[model samples]
Target chain A: MEDPLGKLMPSEVEFIAEDAPITITPNFQAGVFLFLKERVGPFKPQRPMEVPMWLAVSLRRRDKCVIHVPEWLSVDALTTKLEEEKMQQKQFVHMPAHFQEISSILFDVASQDVPNSEECRQLIQAIVDVRTAKIRQGGLDDMKDSLAIQLNNVTQMEITSIRQFACHAMDAFNRLSSV
Target chain B: MSYFDIDDILMQEERLPCVASIDVIKMGSLDPSSATPYLRKGSKVDLPLWLIKSYREKNGEDIFEVDPPKFLGPKYLDMLRADATVINLQSWCSHFFSFAITYLTLFQDGDLATTIQDSFGHRYLVILDISQNAVQDDTSEKTRNLDQLERQLFHAGLQDDRAQQQWRRRQAHRILPWAGAPRRDAFELGHLTKRPKLSFS
Candidate 1:
């Protein structure tokens, strides 16, 4: 009966990912602004400083700063990761727990700042496709007899996406086997 | 099961083949064909699972002998063993797994439970694959033959698959208007109070 709705909504996940750190260079001088949960920035002109993604997005919208795209979301880095994912077909490749949410949200808010943003989006989509296909195709073998499986390097986004189906399947399997 | 579980209530109504080993007194209404004042010895009748269990509980266990239903018998087991994936379990019984579970409780039958587990083990992945990939397609045809429990599992998988795809498409953030929400122009300040009568036509 618990988890009837089964995991957070994608928007809620994006909200959680907002707290993750990003680098931003402000165009205008502003003193430290204190938010409810965290304090951010004595922003100086032409100087790079660490800030949360939400703050960067807000600042970018106001023409106050430009976001510095993270290295992992770069096109070249993602291409390398995709190759590794394809090479190691049997195992999941490690990523940030909220990479999917972060990447998508960044693309939404800071596409101009991110170089080769479209190619990066496509590469990230391809990586997600490859991983999901692996799960759907071969990942079920280990679950045939056991309730638990080793989820090495699997991300929170991946886990949440499949949590509903996996939980229901395992519950049914458990009921049948127990009988 | 809780008092309000409809599935448990329905499963309890599944009739079992029961033979009265000894004369049963004042229970003749259960069998319309019996002419005796009380149920006579060696009378065969199909009784609901609840009645059979009640007899076993309220009275001694010797009054009735419950024969294993034909569906769980060797013949059906052989059919199931031959090819479980192709079997139309719904045609045999509505609540097949639940009924089997109840049967296992009343009579400790390891073989029955094993057969069930094996069939489910084979079919579960196929159902998962179908539900996961068949977005926008009519899956009722595919799920028509599944047992009740299996059908529920298929639906669960289907829902999750669709949810992930929807979130990926950025459609998860659209807030639908509530059913009874007030309209945007529902009550203007001017509309709430009496408007001054329009001067000059």
Candidate 2:
């Protein structure tokens, strides 16, 4: 509600995305604690348990847990994804809908937990750059004269990035087309 | 155009070259130099769009044959057709696209509308590129030629780009609260209880 522009802030999108589940190995032993609705833990030493990203980040920040990087976030996987993204001229590779947010959070909070963190970061950056360039170069030209443009497998951040331009341009096109 | 749209009102104030096809009575003063009380047949005058609209004939034929502004003429259109990205749309008309659309709608010229759409497409790409990359850089010269609508579109893209940059630097939020929220630190001593009154005495 505080956002007057009626567009979600990047940080706000990150906040919503932090609810996606991630696996973490907590160092401390603890029984299940009632977190809002569902019970959350039974944290035992070195036992990887799936929990919300928020919980994992909290535990990692306090030196109580090691976040297990998701399979897609690994260097090998992201490299292949980056190559796949480049190979597809007009199609967006299907990524975790919350890939940008989740990756940013992981890199910020638990880079040490993941092996080859630097390479993984670089690979993710490459994937994002290639994808963004594809969207700009290929997706936008198809937008002319049409009321709606199809963009399958697009992520939330990618959509957010172009939301203002897309909406305004479509409105402008519709106005001209009404003649 | 909507009643409260300031841009439409401003555009309507811009004059159009028009010629009276038939004799017009008691409207001679519309031309500043005319001494006669009645406008003579086949008289030429520059009239605002609003006045031209109000002077419509009962048979639905335009009382004044309006000559489109020079910007919509073949020369300017040819220039646009060549490369729309280089044209200074603001100098030609601050509301260039809007005026073109309105003119096309009124005249029912299908081809002119297509020309406008084509130019818009070309200009949109340039605008998108400029706005997305101008991050924290001075782009005064780059954006100087943009028309009002295009300028708004540029600003929209610029804001999103700047937001992403700020977010990456970790300067976008004061405190990264646990996982979900950038906590605002809502609680304060004053919010819990009333403050002591300041006495004048």
Candidate 3:
């Protein structure tokens, strides 16, 4: 299905060397949004904060690649596949199915990039507004409300998933700025 | 000289528990009832150092010393105007804020102050948590406050609202065709690890 927001930036996807070391420069806004999203997952109540543009960028880049995978899905297993894909980048081979599935998350995001488009721009603005409000007002209560669904069922693994997404969003934006 | 010796500074009797002054004040006879209006009901956390100094200079050391004017809240709620790290988990409000605020005060640097001011806009409360210490990772609460600290710092760094708007709102997105995208999907455990196939449905 087509993404309603059109917020993805598929063209911006980059293929770093499997041997390429990932580095991150400090970015407060992007970091915060990633943290927030990771903690609550999607479909949280609307927060009155502004969204960092960089995170929007990260979300977009994530939507571009379609990483297909078989049913055996786990972060560690995915990491292994990503590593294998990187190592095989020298031959420019297609990544494993799991990597493709993960890339689909990014691709879904990439499909929405319309930086020049008004709809996309407005959505970006809305994100920023939400982020700013939350950052200023404090998100503790908001977090509780948003994660209320999962809070009772929350596990360390879920928290780790949030952290990984946050890390991904952060890495994508930092990489975008340099290019 | 060993590089690890530098870490010993955090271990000194004076700094152990990393908040000697706050402890003295907490144990003293200050009236929680007399706290200022801004004080959150549960936010009895100590005012970070720079703020303490600012409070001391403004209200006089005697008054502040009588009772630490720390922000009130859980240790996880403690925040500052800069990025959080493992180091921040053990930080005292007086020491950390004093360090940053002092640098800003002395240097008369616009960036630092702007960052701090920006943080204030976010309702980022700086507090001292004795439960958290920088010297060791043995406690159940390990680098937990670091998350709060990093969020505050991100807002501080974006002090230039106009610039941020100009860049994020006007320029970059206007030029790029794919800047806006849908939100990312939450990570699934299965996505991160492998599972055996189920035989029947």
Candidate 4:
């Protein structure tokens, strides 16, 4: 039984697991009801309330609500963490697996509300480049011991690229060896 | 056998048939017996990477444009890694290797090829552990046996002496400088000699 959706990285798995709670402020004057397994709201106009991150992202995308940036994702906190990660060698800094994806989604859908969003994006990009360079330099040595390589702060797409490269290399070796 | 050895065996199961990409074209004069597929002039069709490479070599024309497989990209890899058990890993691996083997055969350098080969050898041990854990959680013996039978069929097809010789010849020709270098005319001298000049002082 192939687990088609199980190929997600740890952070993506976490994202699905957390179903993280977020706070949002709706702009409309009247309450709107969102029905899922159960009716969630009579979401009041201009009233701040807690909901899952997925719902918040969706609602924000629709321009119905303004989402609050989580404390860890704030510019000041991420900048400090980025500096710490830069100094470390093999050890990755603590961050959600889907941090990059979540931030990108948030920044794209709710940029106006996230403070210093531009600078945050730059820091995230720099941190990613530095970590990826380190991993590439370390090559298979670092990856050899770990069951699932800790790709903290990297996007799901980046992880996929790495896996694809590994797969290609494996195929090439098999072909060459058989000959 | 070690974990890496098993992974190598599993990975090898993914190779696609060499001629899997060929299709019939109604209007073209392409001989059915030829290795390359017939393509009508001014018509557009997505050709497999290997077929395109074969045509380019034979015709000495760079007419076909290659679109690298999407499965080799990040989106597909990410999905595979997070939930290794859910997707058809074998199918994806086969599609990827079909194009990849063709690409590497045509373009690989000695150092890069060695590095890629080494990486596969080293990383498979770890990947095998991960894959085993995922497999244990879901896959049954029936599916495993079916996968084994399919792999045997693929390996048998590849073991054909004629096909193996053909592939070897292509590879040897690709690497042999004399085979690819332009022919020099018989009148052309191999070495230049200094002509003696009579200098009257």
Candidate 1 per-residue lDDT over residues B1-201, each given as its tens digit: 477788778878988888888888998877789887788888889988877777767865668888877788899989988888888888877778878877777777888888887887788878877887876668889888888877877787777777778888878666455579755455464443332221111
Off by over 4 Å in 2: A1-5, A29-39, A42-45, B54-59, B173-201
Cα-based lDDT for every prediction: 0.78, 0.79, 0.30, 0.50
- What is the per-residue lDDT of model 3 for residues B1-201, given as tens digits with 9 covering 90 to 100? 143543222222121111223323343323345344333223333443444444456743323332322321233224444343333433444223323333344235554454444433233233112211123434335333533333323222222232233333223233353346432332343443322221111
Candidate order by decreasing lDDT: 2, 1, 4, 3
Clashing pairs in 2: none
Q: If chain B of candidate 3 is superposed on the true chain B, what is its TM-score? A: 0.21
C-alpha positional error of residue B119 in candidate 4 after TM-score superposition, expressed in Å: 10
User: lDDT (0-100) at residue A50 of candidate 1?
Assistant: 95
Task: Determine which window of 10 residues in candidate 2 chain A has minimal summed lDDT.
Answer: A1-10
Q: In candidate 3 chain B, where is summed lDDT lowest over 10 consecutive residues?
A: B11-20
Strongest candidate by DockQ? 2
- Candidate 4, lDDT over the whole model: 0.50
lDDT tens digits, residue span B1-201, model 4: 243655344443432223223343542433343444554443444444445565668866455444434654457645644544444535555433333444566655464344434434443433333332332324343234222322332232222222223322332122223355534442255332332221211
TM-score evaluated only on chain B, model 1: 0.81
Candidate 1 per-residue C-alpha lDDT over A1-179 given as tens digits, one digit per residue, 9 for 90 to 100 = 23565456556666777899989888887666655466676778889999988878887887788889888999889999999999986888887678898889888888898899999999999999988887765556557678776767877677666777777777766666666
Judging by lDDT against the true structure, name the best candidate. Answer: 2
- The better-scoring model by lDDT among 1 and 3 is 1
Better of 3 and 4 by TM-score: 4
